[model samples]
Structure formats: C-alpha cells, structure tokens
Target chain A: MKTIGKDRFGKIIDKSYFPLLVVFALVTLIPVYILVKISISEPVDVLTQHPTFLIHNFTLEHWEKVLTSGRLWPAFTKSFVVATLTAIFAIFIATPASYVISRLPKKVKYIVILTLFFTRMFPNVGIALPISVKFIRWNLMDTYTGLVLAHLIEQLPFITWILVGTFEVIPVDLEKSAMIDGASRIRSLISIVIPIATPGIAVASLFVWLNSWNEFTYALYLSLSENTLPLQVYYYVNRGGFFQTATYATILTIPVALITYALQRYLKSDYLGGAIK
Target chain B: MKKFFQKYHLEILLILPLTLYIMYFTLLPVLTTINLGFINADTNVFSLENYEYLFGRDDFRKAFSNTVIISILGLIMQLTVGLILALILKKTFKGKGFFRALILTPMGVPTIVSGVALLYIFDTQGYLNELIYRVTEGLKYIGIIASSYKFIPIDWASGGIRTLFMIVFADMWKVTPIVTLLLLAGLESISLQVYEASQIDGASKWQTFKNITLPLLKPSITMTVIIRAVDLFRIFELPMILAGKNTPVIATFAFEEYRLYNNPNISGAAATILLVIIMIFVSLYLKYIDKGEGLA
Candidate 1:
C-alpha cells in the first residue's frame, strides 16, 4: 500500500511536469512572438480594437520601409563599428593582462580580480556623464573613438574577468612544456595557450560586441548626432507609430538573435558559473 | 633597474596598458563625478548647493524614493520568479535543453528592445488588452459574467503604480532568465550523491530540499541579489522609454538634469548618490561572500 502510494505520487509528478514547463516556455516566448508578429502584421489587422494573436494579414512593407528609409544603414554602421572596435580593443588589451593575472600569486590575484569586479558593477549613468563631459572638452564628442573608449570602460573589466577565468582553466603545463622546448614565454602563450583559449576569447568578444551594440546611455550623452542602432530604435519608440517602431526594433534585435543562436551551445551554466566567484 | 626590466619586461608590457587604461578612464571618471557633485557650477567653489537644490526639488525626492522602492520590489519579483524557474529547470525532463535555451533567449534581447516590445504589449490598444478582451468575451459566452460586461483597456504607461508595475514586469521579462541561469549553475554544482544519501536516510523530498538544497544555493542567491540589485538601482531605459518624465528614477533624474535642465552639478550629485549606494552594497557583498579565499 505504501509502495503504491509512492508510485502514484511519482506518476502524478511525471504527468504534470512536461505540461507545466511548456506553459512556462510559452510565457517566456510569447512576447517575442508578439513583437515579431506585429512587425510583419498589416496595419488593419493590428491597429484595431481587437488585435488577434494569429497573423491574419502578413506583410513585409514595414521591413522594406525600414531598409529603404536611409536611417537604418547609418545607425547600423555606427553600432557595428563601435561594437566591433570595442570587441577588438577589449580582447587585445584584456587577454595579456588576464593571462598574467591568472598566473599571479593568490592574494595579489584576488585584489586585482576584486578591482575588476567592482568596476564592472559600476552604474553606467554614474560614469557616462563625466566621460561625456570630458570628451566634449577634448573635442572627442560624436566621434567613434569617444564612444569606443566609453564602451571599453565597461567591457575591459568584464572581458578581463572572464578571460582570467578562462586562462585559469588552461593548464600552465602546456605553456611550460613549450617553454622547455626552447620556445619563449611569449611564444608559448601565443602559439599554445591562446589557441586553446580561443573559444573563451570568442565568447567574451561576442558579449562585448553585443553590449556595445545595445548600449544607449553613453551614446545618448556622447553620440548626439550619430545615433547608434539602439538610439535609433529609441527614437522611433518615442515618436514613431507602432508598426515602424516594431520594424526598427526587429531590425535591432536580428543580430542579437543570431549571435544568441550561435551561442546556444555555450550558454550552459558552466560558462557563466564563474561570474560571482 | 635594467636587470629588473629585462626580467619582467613581457609582464609589464602586457599588463601596463590595461591598468593604465582602467585608471585613466574608469577610475578618473568616478573621481571626477564625485568631485563635480560637491562643487558649485556657477562659482567653482566646493559646496553642498547641488545636494541642497536636488533635495529641495519635488521630482528629485520622488525619483530618490522611486528608485529605492523599485529596486527592492523588482529584486523580490525577479528573484522569486527566477528561483521558481530555476527550480523547475533543475529537474530532468524531456526537451529540457530546448526549453532552457528558449527561456534564456530574452537575455540577448537589448534593453531598449525589451522596453519597446513591452510597450507594444502593454499599450492601451496593445496585445495584452486584446488578450483580455478576447478572454472576457469567451467567458461571457460561457455565462461567467454579465452579457453587457466590457473589458476596460488599461493605459499601462500612465504614471504611478501602474507604470511601476509595467517597469518591474518588463525587467522581470528580460532579467529573470539571467538569475535562472546563475541559480541553475549553483544547483548543478551540488553532487547527486548527496541527494541519494538523503533519500537513503528516509528523508522526505521537502525535508531533503530544506536541509540540503537551500543551504548550498545560498551563494548563488547572494550573487544574483547583488548583481540584480546594482542593475535595478540604475534602472534607466525602461522608465525613460515607457513613462518618460511621468516616472523618474535616479538615473533618469540625472539624465534630465544634465540634458534637459543643463544642471550638471545636480546631475553629478544624483550620480554620486547612486555610486555611494552601490558602493555600500558591494562592500556588504565582499564582506559576506569573499571570506578571504573565495575568489582564489
């Protein structure tokens, strides 16, 4: 009788678990679905008293308008350039520092890591104002250099922290073996350790790019005239109609979606597990 | 000196650039903002006039309280929802990976896009209201309410509790996935042997969870709280895009002072205040979690 009761309980759980998860998944995804639906939705279908969840009249006219509108390309280019440059510069500066820090003595490593973590947690608005003010005085305002520098303030510490973790996982024996075989320390790092750390570097760089691409506070303060893609989306959100805003927002999200899709395999908990520690 | 340089030249060359860059950009700006907060913009003399002025303003006070209220409320909401989701995802089930990936997709969506998408849903003539209307109509057909009953579409962007709800809801939609991911990592780190042992000892499921899972999950919970607290304190884009001036948080308040009012002193003061609060939180986190060797 007790065994039967336990089996019944287990059976009840088994019966309910999948459906419960399905509901949760649907709730999580319905917003994105609605956004995408609205973007392709015809005006008559969406701009009404009762907008159906199902797309009754599908059209790409909004997408076409956004493409040909002349605003999309410039904003896209600026965001792309800023994000790409931020990623490249971040990886270049952070990699070596991370490698060295990963090999540092424990106490010293803790302090350095703490400093990076502290800076990473800084409020963006807190620094953005001063940086923009300084950039204005230096005549760096509205320039890609200014924006990239501002982005680096946030990305550098983050990339360094992640890369430090990445480097810690790489056995020092590989580099030591190469060094013993007459390779210099630099050569070993370059030819051996770095190759093994490529995946980590790629993930960090992609995240930096995504962050810079989506950044708005610094862009709002610094890039007054040349808006980034997020700023462009914000502009439409403030003033444009529903369809246009949806279209622009969809365009802004496309690359993010693509990158996230590419990153699905690496989105496991282990990659982000070191975030606190 | 020459011998020392020769010995560690690679290390110095590799590490100096980042150290200098961080000191110049990140550290300098923080110091400058703090400095700017105290100085009088008109006289260039150090004073508390900026703070005085900000404190005297109605909107600034509203923003200050709003920031605190939203941070606490939003943190609770996100943590609860995220914990539930994480607990559910921790269980082994079919298509678990697909569901996990799907749920986490929102993390990649930009904050601005989140605001826009949520606005699309919560706007008066938006999808949410439409959903309500359809559901109510269906219910009316089933004799659940008066046949003449009509659903009143809520203008979710309007200021006050409604706007606050929208902002917190939107934040949850975007950020809860991150908290879930972090907690899942913590959960996965716990070995299966412990659970098996608990079962062998004849502990009930709830007893095992209470005695084992909760204790082990504390670190991840602490980390998520700290991270989310910092982010929530600086809540900006959602409030700015959704309710505009009608709802003001500290970050938005700072932006308004700098841009709309051209009062950099007031803006600097607001920013400095936020920085101080965040510093307190960080220090508390360090003291609690980093009992010397955690990072190492």
Candidate 2:
C-alpha cells in the first residue's frame, strides 16, 4: 500500500465522508451496547451500578430465569405456529392472486396493482378492531385461524404485489410455449412460472414470514388465551419483569436477528428494485 | 371483448381468493366501520352520535393531534437521517457491507422486541440512567451540568411530549434503514455520467446533489414517505406497548376506545375517520405518481 502525507490523507478521508461514517457507526452501535449492558447486568446492579460499555461482572442468571420460566417457551411455540401458518396461508392465497394479476389485460393489471397499493397504505388499526371483535363474537378468538387470518391481511398484499413484479419481468414466451404444449394454467404456474419466480417468491415470503412473526398488536388483542412470543415480551415489559429477565429478551432477539440476516439480501434486493428507476 | 376476456380468465381466477380476502378485510370492514360510526350505542339506531362525540370531544382531539405530530416528526426524522445514511453509504467505504447489514437488522426484529429494548434503556434504573450517572460523575470532576444537582427523574414512556419524542426516535431507528436502502437505490439509478457532466459545467457537490439528485429522487422519495407515513400512522403495538393508551395514536386510540373504554361506536368513528384520511392520501398519491409516470 502507498502511504500519502498525513495532511493529504486527512483531507481525502474528510472529503470521502469519514465524519458521516463515524456518525452512522455511533448511532447504530449505541443501542446495541446499551442492550448488551442491560441484558447481562444483575437486576440488583441494574439499578445501582452505572451501565457500562463493558460489564464489570457477567452473569447468566437473567437468561437462566427466562429459560426456567414455563411461560416463555409456550409463547415462543405459539409465535412459531402463527408465523408458519401465516406464511403458508399467505403463499397459498397470494400465489394465485399474483398469477391472475400478471395474466390480466393491461388495464385490469393496473387496477389490481392499484388495489394492492391501496391495501398497503390502509392502516391495520382501521379494520383490526372490527376483525378482532368479529372473531371474538364468532368464538374464533384465541384460535390459530384468527391470528393467521389477521396476519394474512397484511401479508397477502405484499406477497402478491411483489410476486406480480417478479412475474411481470418473466418473458411471456416461456409460459406461452408451455401453454401451447397443453400445460394447464395451474401446471404452467407450478412447473413453469414458480421456478422462474423463486427469487421474488423468496423475497416476498421472507417479508410475510417476518411480518407474521413480529406481529404483536392483533395477537395481543385476539389471543387472550394463547400469547405469541412478542405479546409475551410486551407483557414481560408491562408487568415490569424484563428487569428480572433481560437475558431471555436478548436471547429472544437472536433468532429474529439471525433470520433477518438470512433474509436481508432478499429485502435489500426488493427495496432496490422498487426504489430505483 | 370476448377474446380479451378469454385470454385473462385464468388469471382472474387466480385473483379470486385475494380479491375476496381484501374485500372481507379491507373494503367490507371499512364500510361497516363507517356505518358503525353513525349509530348510537344505547338506541342501536343511526344517529351520527359517534361522529358528534368525536367532533365534540377533547380526548379524540388529543389523539388526532398527537398522532399527526408523531407521524410528521417521525417522517422528518426518518427522511433526514435516512438521506444522510444513504448519501454516506452510497460511496465506497470500509465495512460498507457490514454497516448495511447492521442497519437493517433492527427492521426484522419484532416491534415488541424493540419496544422492550427501548424500555430497558429509558426506564428509571435503565441503561440511560447508568450512562447519565457516569457522565455526571465525569462532569463533576470537570465542572459542568451542576455536579450537585440530581438529574430530574422523568418517566420516558408516558404519552407526554418526551414519550412522543421517544416514539419518533424508535420509529426512526426501526425504519430509517429501509428509507436509506430505498434512497440509496434511487441514488444508484442516477448515472454517474450526469454528475460528471454537471461537474464539468462547474457545478459544486451541493449543486449537483440539489439539481440533479433531488429531482430524479422525488418520485421514489415521495412514494417511500407516503407508504411509511401510512404504515406508521396505523402503528398499534409499539406505541401501545411502549407508551400505553396514554399516547393516543389513531390506531391505538381505536384499540383503547374499544378495549378499555368499551365504546365500540366511538372506536368505530375514530377508525372511520382515520380510514378516510388514509384513503385520501392513497388516492392523492396514486394521482401524483401516475402524473409523473404518465400512467394517469
């Protein structure tokens, strides 16, 4: 490596946004530092000792408490079930919707696309109340169906819209050739279209999956008997028990963080596609 | 017409479930909610009482005002910081990939997880206080911020101005990466040749950014802002979990009206009003975006 004079290097670095890099790094890292510090600290020390960037004493007691606690595991199981079911439900409903939207006439395609767009913008709170109350009245409250349906409301639009984008990019000729060879529309979608659109499907499924997993409000409102992990986490905080169990909360974040990391590339690509000209 | 219909019939069949689902969840609920808003609870008769209650109420007014303030402030914060992040990360840098990954990790973590994390930091005995104590001790040795004065204990999670600020901050943390990612994509689409041409014409960095970058970015930026605004406006769990019913967002307000207040008509009215605002924004955005793309 060639070394430049100190002043020259300084100027170059400044010009190239050394300051901005530092700011972003600080902004991003501070919360993580705070979280780690709080998580490992003893509940007694959490109050008395000033939170440090480096822990003076480390303990897994909080993690122990969270693990040994019976309620935590059940909630985690519930969240997993809800998220998985929502993903399956969303894919089932959205795949067909995406196919139809992509196959429609140009005008109809535009209309359907517009509908999806509007659905995305419409706030969940607007309908969530009625839906939850309806579920309650229908005795679907605390049921997997209710949670799955609620998640579908958010997941369906995104999955279908993103899938539509994927399908639109595919040349019509491939599917046309398949159709001409006597493959049915369903067959063409399954054998021809889906394989070609796997990347987009991956991106959309990741989004729907993450949305379903992270969903808390509707779960909290609907599942009076069965709480998802997020709802339990909320209750943990509300009940002033996070201090008693910060390690579990930190541990809880690990799976989500890992899955998110796995899905980050897809999300990045999707955002890039939508945001770019 | 027959040929057109035949060609698309299969496609339309696929759309059926989604159409039905959206109708049931989106359109039907909204219509029913609006109808619900017009009825009185005691009489179970149409009376516009719910709307009158909202219009004549202080709590409803507070909720609306607070929601707007949080949305506007949060939007501005997200855009400003997100733009900075995008601009910085657009160029070559060491650990660029690492930073990008780090930035978006929070987005995938559940909202309640984040809310829980914030509570740990902002709680009285939380990390923030610990940091404050350390800083105060250092300040005492150096002579600043009154070494003798105990820092005022303020509950950060209350729906007061401070909690609203935190809500905006949490929202920014959760979403700025997304905006940054989007804006970076927008920035990348602009050819470097255009920038070089502008530079050749003696344009400054700021000038090329303002003239070339901003105009091209308008469409993406507008869409990003509008989409995020609508989504955040409907925010339920974060505010409710973090700030509780004290902080009245439009979404949580409805939840409170129904859950805590036990007034479905009032909740329906509030939800209906919020729904109308969102629809207006969506239609306006559709119109505006189409004008730019010539889709209209």
DockQ of each: 0.59, 0.44
TM-score to true structure, per model: 0.94, 0.91
By summed lDDT, the worst window of 10 consecutive residues in model 2 chain B runs over B287-296
A122 in model 1: Cα distance from truth in Å? 1.6
Measured by TM-score, the strongest candidate is 1
For model 1, give the RMSD to the true fold: 2.5
Query: What does candidate 1's lDDT look like per residue over A32-93, in tens digits?
Result: 88888999999988888778889999999999998998988999999999999999999999
For model 1, the local distance difference test gives: 0.85
B1-296 per-residue lDDT for model 1 (tens digits): 99999988899899999999999998888888888899999999999999999899999998988888888889889988788788789898778888888888897788889888888789898888988898899999999999999899989878788889899898889887888988888888899999998777766656666899887777777778777888898999999888788889999999989988888888889999998888787677658654433332
lDDT of 2 by residue, B233-263 (tens): 7777668767876777878888778888888
lDDT per residue, candidate 2, A20-39, as tens digits? 66677666666666666766
Best by DockQ: 1
Off by over 4 Å in 2: A1-16, A269-277, B1-8, B144-150, B281-296
Name the 10 consecutive residues with the lowest summed lDDT in model 2 chain A. A1-10
Candidate 1 Cα errors over 4 Å, as ranges: A1-16, A269-274, B1-6, B284-296
Give model 2's TM-score versus the native structure. Answer: 0.91
